[model samples]
Target: MTEQGQSMLNRTVRKRHQLSAESIAKDLQISCGLQISITAVRRELHGMGLHKRAAACKPYITKCNAKRQMQ
Candidate 1:
């Protein structure tokens, strides 16, 4: 995995929080100088099992969004 990828995972664990793939990808590009897409970030997070967690307000929203976008 890329250093940025590792850092992303670490941040998620440290914060016990998850961010959207777009947010992570933007951070990687702007902060870490890594040019990657949200889709790539999503794939990486899936491989790491570190993707966004369910939210209290709309528990399945993220999953639904992912499915829609992928479709």
Candidate 2:
């Protein structure tokens, strides 16, 4: 890939919460004018070892419970 393509990939991957192949492809298409499909993005991410992984969310605690627990 060219410098422009690399830049697009970086930007797309960075913008996402986690490296998402789909978002990367969409961003590349919009930013780099590549018109690439999601599958292509997945392949590229897989090649780069940047495939999206499941993200774990922290448990939510209410403010009242938090205060009580702090006591």
Q: Residue 47 CA error for candidate 2 (Å)? A: 1.2
Q: How does candidate 2 score on lDDT?
A: 0.71
Per-prediction TM-score = 0.54, 0.53
Which regions of candidate 2 are displaced past 4 Å? 1-3, 55-71
lDDT of 2 by residue, 1-71 (tens): 66667667766776764666666677677766888777767776677767567758987899998998999
Query: Compared with the true structure, what per-residue lDDT tens digits does model 1 show for residues 1-71?
Result: 67756776557545645568777777667766777787877877787766566736855558779899899
- Candidate 1 yields a Cα-based lDDT of 0.69
lDDT (0 to 1) per candidate: 0.69, 0.71
Candidate closest to the true structure, highest lDDT:
2
Residue 69 lDDT in model 2? 92
Error (Å) of candidate 1 at residue 23 is 0.7
